[model samples]
Target: MKTIPVQLKSKDYDILIGRGLRAQIGTEVAKVWSKRKIALVSDKNVAELYLKEVHQSLEDAGFDVLDLVVPAGESSKSLAQMGDLVQQMADAGFTRADGVLALGGGVVGDLAGFTAASYMRGIAFIQVATSLTAQVDSSVGGKTAVNLKEVKNIIGAFYQPDLVLVDPDFLDTLSDRDLVEGYGEVVKTSVLHGQDFFALTGKIKSVQDIREQAEELSIHSIRYKAKIVMADEKESGQRQFLNFGHTFGHAIELLSHGSLRHGEAVSIGMVMISQRFEAVGITEKGLTDEIAQRLAAVGLPIDSDLVGTPLFFKHIVNDKKNRGGILNLVAVKNVGEPVIVAKALDDMHDFV
Candidate 1:
């Protein structure tokens, strides 16, 4: 087992990563959180496979488990679904003393975490990350939110989890596409960390490689994020590095209208922004090709035809990074070096 501690001033927590950690969920959770009644939130797809095992584990640990399953997809992260979940928890007699346990992927984690953060003001939240995306990225970060029609993760909170269990065991059942989709964030982290991780990520060629190296790669991404989160918990300054590919990535995602996965979108965004920035001399020459080559090596695309979508500009301006009139864009100078470049929202159309 590998333990990485995220030492926030008030909400410090540990992220436990290992192969068989899923089976030890209940026991592991009991060590940090003492809540008696907990809501086990999952999606329909995941519930059919590992829900019973996880639920049984929680029950064995003396938890009054409330199994809350929702539809599985990006759509689940919505105001309607969040309201329904809050009402259900209220109907179940939940209190601030209780907690929430997210059992599926990012959707479940985001929804459950947000619900826990808002339930009677706040409650403990734990993450049992199932997907590679969740385990490697979303599971470790305290950022939680649902979508707002066109915008993604627009309404959310920075609520840290009490504990996060990232067991590679749960990754066994993911589809090939689902697994590869996660490499987008991996590639993003690699670029942010510089040469060491950049070279390491380039070695991942298949799901077999990812499975074999999950623990190591997960730790790399978590440590990078945890360090940045601890320094700039509310994204005042230093934390913007984490949004390296996300400005255009999120815009591309909104424009695709769910056609592309989040990671895929980010992959294209990373390369696109790098390509455009490198052309303008903001990013180092050859950096775009390097990023594109690594992403393509792992089967992630570096470009998308949706870049021409008329709604593209609109989505870009709506991003959270666009504070006041300046868009805080993350651009690359070299491998492992990312810089934030502020651009006027009105002047964005010609930058592409």
Candidate 2:
């Protein structure tokens, strides 16, 4: 097992990554919560696969575990579900002293993390991310929230987890499409960091290659994000780079109405943004095409069927990064270079 420390202003935490670390969750979690009960939040899919193992581990460690299972999917991240989970935690005798165990992919992490953040005004929590997307992206960052009717991740908080336990073995059950979708996020991280890191993706083609390189790839991606988050935890500056493809990605997801996966949408969004950069002469045409082609190779669409440029631009206007009606955008000057552009909302239509 390899443990990485994430240093934060409020408190420092550890991210333990390895194969078969699920069996050690109880002892690992015990270091934070001694006799305090833990409320575990998971979805139906993950619950069927590993919930029993987690329950047995915690039970062996003498923890009073209360299991709360929600239906799996993006739609489950609603205000109603959040309220229900909060009520469940309370009925189970939870307190600020107790911990929350987020035991699924991004949706479960976001919902449960927000619950832990809001319940009792804030409680300790641990993340046991089950998907590749969650392990490399959402689980490490403290950004937790559910979606609102009008916006994606609009209602969320930046509450850091007490610990992040990532077991790559959990990925064995993922379908081919889901596995391929995760590479979109991996590619995003690679682009933000640089080309050498991006080149590592070349060796990864099949699902087995993704698995064999999972440990190193996850650690490398997390390290880049951790450094950026540490430098600007509140996102006043450098951390914005992490949202390289997210602004456009979130808009596509909104337009698709949850029909499109987040990473898949982001893959297309990244391609679109790269094209915008090329149009403005900020990036070379070949490089932009290469990015789109690579994403296509992994089964992510580089363009969407959504029919209106103005509507797509409207979503960009609503993005959280828009400041004073000006969009703080990240564009590529080349494969290894990312430049931030501040543009007025009116000028966005030309690019879209």
Candidate 3:
């Protein structure tokens, strides 16, 4: 097993990545958690797959485990669902001494992490990420949120996990489409790290290549994010770069009514923003095409003709990155170097 530490002073935690770490979750979690009661949160789909084993593992380790399952989709990340979870934890008499275990993908991680954040003003939580997106991005960053009616992640907090357990073997059960969508995050992380890293991703030929190299790829991506988060935990500066494709992507996701996966929307967002940056002289020409091609190679959409330009701009105005009237969009000078660009909400029409 390879461990990457996210050094955030008092909030410091380790991300454990390997092939069979899930089987040892109880032992691994017991090392950090002295609490007796633990809440295990998962989606229905994931619960059917790995809940029993994980539950048994915790039980064997002497934890009083309470397994909670939500519906399996983005829709489950809602105020209603979060309230239900909070109430359930209350009824079970959980306290700050107890910890939450998020045992599924990004949706579960975000929901459970946020629940932990709001429950009793804040309790500890651990992430046992099953999907590639969770393993690489959401599970490491501490950003947790639930979507509102028209916005994605509109309600959330920066609650760091106590530990993150990533077992690549869990990915063996993912559908082909679910698996490929995660490569979008891998591509985004590579681009942010720059040309050499981007080039490394270019060599991956198929989903099989991604799976075979999951350990290395996941570690690299997690390390990049960990470094940034340690520097700017509250996202006042450098951390905004991590949202390279997210601003436009979230709008597309809301417009699609969750039909578009987060990574899929991000794939298209990166291309759109790159093209706009190039046209405005913020980035060199051909960078857009390069990113689009890389995303396309991994079976992600490069562009979507269905997204209405006006509505897209409407959602951009509501993005959390927007401060006062300026939208703080992350632009690339090239593959690895990212720059934050501030634009008025009215001025956004030119880019769209």
Query: Quick one: RMSD of model 1?
Result: 1.1
> How well does each candidate superpose onto the true structure, as a TM-score?
0.98, 0.96, 0.98
Return the top candidate by lDDT.
Answer: 3
Query: What is the descending lDDT order?
Result: 3, 1, 2
For model 3, the run of ten residues with the poorest summed lDDT = 304-313
> Candidate 3: deviation at residue 257, Å?
1.7
Residue 32 miss distance in model 2 (angstroms): 2.7
Clashes by residue pair, model 1: 194-336
Which TM-score value belongs to model 2? 0.96
**Residue-level lDDT tens digits of model 1 in 231-331:** 88889897898888788788888888888899999999998888889989988898888888877876887898777566888888778888998999898
CA error at residue 279 for candidate 2, angstroms:
1.8
Q: Give the TM-score of candidate 3.
A: 0.98
- Residue-level lDDT of model 3, residues 129-214, one tens digit each, is 99999988989889999988777789999999989999999999998788888889999999898776788788887888888888
- Local distance difference test, each candidate: 0.88, 0.85, 0.89
Worst 10 residues of 2 by lDDT: 305-314
Task: Give per-residue CA lDDT, model 2, range 215-267, as digits (tens).
Answer: 88888788888888888888888788878878888888888876888888889
Angstrom error at residue 308, model 2: 4.4
- Decide which is better by lDDT, 2 or 3: 3
